[model samples]
Target: MEKTFLELISENQSILFKICNVYFREKVDKEDYHQELIIQLWKAFPDFKNTAKFSTWMYRVCINAAIDILRKDKKEIKKLVFQKSTYIIYLIMGLSPLEIRKDCLN
Candidate 1:
């Protein structure tokens, strides 16, 4: 099972890379995200009931990991500027306008 999982991961490595690219700005951040995704996948493997395709399961795992990382690293954008007049900050942070307004009020 371990060997099979290793082979599967090797074959689908690009999935990890793509997720990392979507979420991370620096190469090191991408690598960290990839590693986190792999760890999450391994931890969740035993309970994978296999109702869906492996790639589908993997994609969900990758996206969840990327989002988790994004949430954690959100404060890293403190120095970056978004036009204050528009909803650009909300858009960049992947929040809906309602969510952004709620956040801002807090």
Candidate 2:
């Protein structure tokens, strides 16, 4: 299982590079981010249900990991930006705008 996972990851590894490039501007950060992404993939691999394409699943995991890292690294700015975007998503999904704003602010 580990070998197969590693092979699949290697094939789709470009996803990692693209995410790190986008979310990590510094070379050092990119290296760190790449390692974290691989860790996340390994942790989540066993739970993969195989309902989706491997690359698509890889994208979801990597993107989520990248966002998680950014959220931690840029707490204040990321919260504001992410909250506003999440607020819009909630609105589109029929959630009350007031509730969304209150939740985002808090």
Best by TM-score: 2
Alpha-carbon local distance difference test for all models: 0.80, 0.90
Winning candidate number (lDDT)? 2
lDDT of 2 by residue, 23-81 (tens): 89999999988999999999999988888999999999999999999888888787789
lDDT (10s digit) by residue, model 1, range 47-104: 6777988888899988987787777667555434343544685778798989988877
Please estimate how well model 1 matches the true structure, expressed as its whole-model Cα lDDT. Answer: 0.80
- TM-scores for the candidates: 0.65, 0.69
Which run of 10 residues does model 1 get worst, by summed lDDT?
Answer: 77-86
How far off is residue 63 in model 1, in Å? 0.4
Lowest summed lDDT window (length 10), candidate 2:
97-106
